[model samples]
Target chain A: MRNLADEIERFILRKLAGETNDITILQRNELADELSCAPSQISYVLSTRFTAERGFIVQSRRGSGGFVRIVRVPVQKIVYNKPDNIMDYCSPEDFENIIIKLNSERMITAREAGLIKYFLDVIDDYVNPVEKMRIFRSLLITLENNS
Target chain B: MRNLADEIERFILRKLAGETNDITILQRNELADELSCAPSQISYVLSTRFTAERGFIVQSRRGSGGFVRIVRVPVQKIVYNKPDNIMDYCSPEDFENIIIKLNSERMITAREAGLIKYFLDVIDDYVNPVEKMRIFRSLLITLENNS
Candidate 1:
């Protein structure tokens, strides 16, 4: 079911989509009033949806003269660095961030991201960490070539 | 290092690629002789590399008349059924299989599959099972619409 968070996300996304520089600034209180919701709701949506993994970085200043800044990360800034502890067993949250990063960078499509998440959710425990790392590294190399 | 197993996997993949029907059969002894490796080595490669998780299936007739049959699963026969215990924490192996199945069906590209695997490997533990399933189901719905 669509909720206030969904609506807020769509509204913000629409605003960003219409911008030429892939960025936008909003007055938080104004946005809240426009959306007919509380300012806290806007904060929640911004924090969750406008995350780095999702290709967005949101900066907001609190109080009467504050504004929110949403910037879509560009491709050139991506370093594609493998984590230092990549050889160890990766936690699910970290894996999710990678998926988000890929989608945000336009390295993969949304559907592809979804497909990846599905696999992550259902992956068997018996597939050991070493095998997982091997697969992950091989996959990154493949994307590096394609992207 | 290029090991016997890697060579054997390549040889079989090459053979499968060249087949018009996406299926192939070979005598284990003949393949071992041709590859100049032990038959046990061939068995290891077949069991590991040519697996359902990688979108492959092997049927072997044991004994003196042994033959290995490799068949690539087709798309139409996919049931897309969510497992009964989907709400529970998913293991790595099961997720790997889902990724493989998606790749095999051509619903996702090899690079995309790899990207998915990377995320699966690194996903954080804090992202609980319920949230994982929610994200996974949404992703599937998106793919269903796109595919």
Candidate 2:
């Protein structure tokens, strides 16, 4: 039997692959009914599978006419010959490629991507893991919540 | 009389300024007694003042050998002689200087600096003012959260 998280993730990916761009809205209760799960289960799926890192922007409205909208971002096309060299050296072109790809692939909303790019520049001059993690986590959380 | 809030805040800040990184082993009840305040006051101070937003991290243990530890983070120095001089013209040398200073002062972790350099490349590529602000805010928030 497929678990709820897996089900939700599959459903979301399917929607993204199908070219659903203008906010795929779903009501919590209605989705729960359709999936035979609790409303909180929907929240769980949104929190985990649709995180900013993996690249999906989720928004919701509460009360009547309430619905959750998921936007798909586009992925960038950069020819990486070696995956091992991914973070070895990050240049402006590399960062831009990632952002462009993330936006196009629907991994991040335009607003979230914009925010992330801004943060990347500010911390660019600093060289420390603790600080990088700090910035990365903060941007991730903000994008997750705001998107 | 200085209230518990004021006293605890001062004590924590003083310890932090004195280069104390670990303070979790301190006994709450004993601390309250030393300050002639209620134990709950300590809890209140920890929750409100030492939050991640304030750049202080707090952790506590309960039961036998229970204690509270607080770590104070040193404030980041943006490094320009004038605060009004926006970081628009920072050279590679300037960037390197900031990293060295932060590392020597123990202000940022090595990983954080690496991430920052990655982000810097992104900022250098973007020419738009709005884009710059967004990136700057994102990096600042990330730095603030990590430290």
Instruction: Report per-candidate DockQ.
Output: 0.17, 0.05
TM-score of each: 0.34, 0.35
Badly placed stretches (over 4 Å) of model 2 are: A1-147, B20-30, B47-89, B93-112, B121-134, B141-147
Task: For model 2, report DockQ.
Answer: 0.05
Q: Candidate 1: deviation at residue B23, Å?
A: 0.8
For every candidate structure, what is the RMSD over all alpha carbons to the true structure, in angstroms? 22.0, 14.3
TM-score of chain A of each: 0.52, 0.50
What lDDT does candidate 2 reach at residue A79? 20
Residue range A1-147, candidate 2, lDDT tens digits = 345767877876676667635357677898788889998988998987887655556888898898888864322212233252245455656666766775675555454455456665555665454455444544443333322
Candidate 1 chain B least-lDDT 10 residues: B75-84
> Number of the top candidate by lDDT?
1
- Candidate 2 CAPRI level: incorrect
Runs with alpha carbons beyond 4 Å of true place in candidate 1: A1-76, A79-147, B80-147
